[model samples]
Target: MPLRGILDRWNNQSLARQFLIAGGLVSLAAMMLVGAYVTTLIEAAVTRNSAASTALYVDSIIAPLLPDMKTSQRLDDVTTRALDETFGQGALGGKVVSFRLWRKDGTVLYATPDKSMVGKRLDPGEDLLTAFSGQMVAQFGSAEPRDASERSRDDPLLEIYNPILQPWSGEVVAVSEFYEVADEFQQSLHQAQLRSWLAVFGVTLAFFLLLSAIVFRGSRIIDHQQQALTQRVTELSELLSQNKALHARAQRASLRATALNESYLRRLGADLHDGPAQLVAYAALRVDSQLLTDPRTPHQAREKEVSTIKARLDEAMDEIRSICSGLVLPQIETAELPDVLKRAVDAHRQRTGLKVALSMTNGSKSLPPSAKICIYRFVQEALNNGFRHGGGVDQSVRQTFDNGNVVIEVADRGPGFDPASVGPDGLGLAGLRERIESLGGTFNIFTSKSGTTVRMSLNVQEMEQA
Candidate 1:
């Protein structure tokens, strides 16, 4: 479980980091293995070459001085002096630590620097037995040394077994073992091993660096592509949300348009019934009056009644004209936003004799025909309501731009009415809400004892597109 957890953490790291960790471990192992192998080979080759040269020089000096072990396992006094002079005064003088001649039965036949060791019998070790079998065995103290050999000193020592050959028969005779001081050989071997390790390390480091560079470059590319993909997804999500909102607005507008025709006809019928229809009916009743039908009625009285009927008919005609005037819209489709607002305010002031302050700033001049119509009606109706309910004190109409949308606000400093108390009738507030929302706009009303504010926000960009 711990190993699984460790692997999970490792996998979570970036590609560059992962490659650096794994490659570093592998490179370390490879450097150590290869370096150790190369160093071993160099040490072995240096030891063998140095020991062989030293053994040949010693054999030339000491070989002929030895008595043939085939005849006797002892050395003559003359032969002992010859060996001692050779080691003491010759080329192997300081370097030769000790020397010995061994018979086949592990008897020390001759010895130098310690003549008491002569005639002492010792056990024949593996190296001595091999030397008697006609092969030289050489070892260096710095690398591997035998425990009981005379060459096992604190300083580096090279020990060798050089076998003596009989003159006549080529039979195994005896073994000569000697130890040499080997400071130069040890220094050369160390230098060779150091160079081999450095070469291996250099090669391994270069290879790891090249791999790391490539991995890091590819990781950067992958990270960049992932960021770009994430950004693209965010953009697409915003576009989808906008499309859904647009589709919802379209559906509302379609339903509102379908109901508008029926509403208009019903309002027209109600107006005619309340104003012209009543007056026309009253005039017809006056026409069938008993005074006009009776022949005995006086001419003067009849003339007075006839004049009264004419006045009533004229009043009825005026009522019909007023209704027609309220139903028809003025020409405002091609007018700019400022002109549209001015017309509405002026028409209300002319009709009701009320002062309305109109202010516009940062308002879009270009708009759709439907937006212009809606704006005009909104201003006209809002002003009428303010005058009726709030006494129209400080009446003001404002048109402004906010974040690409046009805001229209009608405010008055009067005792405001409760919004909850407003009833659904006469298409006053309800029609205003429908008109604004059909275009995907928003309407809000804020009321208090100090003042009332009715605001509508329309998207100028959407209207321009329409």
Candidate 2:
């Protein structure tokens, strides 16, 4: 459970905190390895120096008493007294605690205060062998091998083994083993270890702090960029929402414009049929009644008068019919786009006797009724303009599909008028633009000195149904 808690805390930590923790752990491991190695080296050096100094002190006290510090020769009464005086109290001002001498064969030659072990043989271990090889060995503990003397002495001691040399030959012959009271030495070694550990900890902490600072700065930068990105996303969402609303409003306005244009066309058609047609019918009746009058004048004079009046009335009626034809449209509500366009061109050729080249491809049966009517009327008007303003020759109407939109183009080889010189009151082009635009379509006119072309494109899928 404790392990789980630690893992959970680590998981929930911020990136900078996690980074610092990981780096700190790695740094701690590195510091521990270096500190342990250095401490081991320091321990070895202190032990070597202490052993050498202890060996020197022991040798100085024992060298004069024994003529052969190496051999297993029995000690005399004078030498025995010297050994007791040196080690029973302490050697070198009470620094030494106990002492022993060994033969090369592992036999105990002498030990102060333990005279019973004088001739007992024991195994010479690795430390004893090292001393016999002319090296000193020391440790801060009781001596080993579980001997009776070691069992009786339990106090912490500096156990040292010093090699005794043959003075004349300079050869190691025996080893001297002894112990020293180590209360002060143990305390001093512990103090050194503590100082070394403190130094290592301080350095590790300083390095960890420096690394944490760098990680903290990077984390803050990441957080700031993330916040800015979030804000940008929010603003983009708002803009998209607003764009959708404006598009809806534009669709509503276009639908309103289309309805108004249709209303105007209906009103114009009604006015021509009701007002001008009635006036022409009444005038024709009056002229016929006058011709039927009896004996008003001589026959030829009356006939010429009636003929002149009849010709003028017929001319007026023809002009009114032409105006009415332009205002009213055929029943093209159920016709397809291609059929509607063909009907308009066919009617123009019948009325004006002008041949129009036609290029058409079949499709767009899905086009709405209003779109079909608009196409028909636009084509009819364009053909009329070609016959009146243009030469009425070499005209063409092309209908095709481009990118899901139906395109109709009418062209004429006529003297073209400048668009800039045309006034806003040019109802033909202006009404065409508004009609196409309302149905989510576009109208464009391209004119050169040689010819004039008007093109209309409509997307029936986007148009409002009527």
Candidate 3:
């Protein structure tokens, strides 16, 4: 119906059908060409070899009758009788039906049973000219219509014109024309031509079959290899997609890590400026004023001023130590998960002097060192936030292991502020969220007028093994 439809149908065809159609068309075209060429060659070969044999037979029997015709330019009485005896009334083995002796100028010297044609000059055609040139020429055709007598005896004839050579000189003197019945010989030639054609066709068919078989096997192998290549390409595409997703995740983690480092630096700067830096600056100012106002006013007063300065210096040192303690963590490489959480809670209690109710459930005790640090920091920050912002009432910390996950919750029964109204730099919630997510954990908060609860869950086995 359409070009596209034809293509679709051909594509849907089976491989065997497609190959067979193509091979058949190719074989037919090749055989047709070969058959035509072979037939032409065989015909030429058969004609050349058959003509040579027939001409040789005619020469041996007929050449003796015309030996002296060069000088006579005509056949004698004896030669004329001999010709009649050879060809008349089914004579000479019934092969020779008729005969003529011609001079070189196409003058008929003798004609058997047709004496009226004798001594008549006619045009010597191409076949007679070839014979007079010392070669025998033969063909199958009717006699020429130029002569009335020849036209009267018309039949399908095997005509031969042979040169009658002089015995001593080996020169052509006269030409002998003969017409023979060739029914049996024609049948044999036909049979040979038929056999040659069949043989050529058989060879062509066999060669085509062999070539088609080779093509079919190779096509099957190519199809299999193509299928394998397609499957391999699909698998590679899937792997590439997975690799791109992993790369994107790594980039996001890198950005979050940078943000966490910046937040940490900002917090450290603020702690130093508010605590140790302010105290140290004030002590320096007071020392400068005393030196300028009363360098030697009273020894006892200067001693008292030295005591106050010493107390202020001692307070500044304590504040610096407190900030340092917050920054530096205890060595807990060899500690258990429960022991690590207990240290954070004990430190909070020592610093704030506020009691926190703590509960724990049996869970995976072993953890990677990074995971231990995350847990301790999370508990520490949540407890500190509760005392500072939640009035430290009904504070509780709970730890449980559920379905291969470590779950932790910190809650307080105090008035909670709205998370939506929180300032950008308050309470380090964003840093806490990033910290938990970086470890492939989750952080969440539930706050209301009753209180606030901070919850975190981590894949214990995965985080520890990683």
| TM-score winner | 1
Worst 10 residues of 3 by lDDT: 141-150
187: Cα error in model 1, Å: 2.8
Question: What TM-score does each of the candidates earn?
Answer: 0.69, 0.53, 0.54
In candidate 2, which residue ranges exceed 4 Å CA deviation? 1-12, 20-37, 70-72, 89-93, 141-155, 248-466
User: Any idea what lDDT model 2 has?
Assistant: 0.78
Rank list by TM-score: 1, 3, 2
lDDT of 3 by residue, 1-466 (tens): 6999999999998676788888789778887887778767775576657766776776776666654776897677787777777666423537766677888888998875567879999898898999999888777644443335545663445777878888889888888787766676677667877887788779978887788788778888888888999999999999899778757866776787786688788888988888888888888887876643686758787777777777888998998899889888898777988888889989988998889888998754677888788888899898888888999888989999878888899999989878888665454676677678878898999999999999998998887677
Task: Report the lDDT tens digits of candidate 2 across residue range 103-217.
Answer: 8888887776567778889889999999888888887654542346555655567789889999899898778887776667777777787888888888988888887888899
User: What stretches of model 3 exceed 4 Å from their correct place?
Assistant: 1-38, 64-67, 72-85, 88-98, 110-116, 140-159, 179-257, 272-466
Compose the digit string of candidate 1's lDDT tens values, residues 335-354.
98899999999988898888
**CA lDDT of 443 in candidate 1?**
92
The best candidate in terms of lDDT = 1
Model 3 pairs whose backbones collide: none
Q: For candidate 2, what is the total of clashing residue pairs?
A: 0
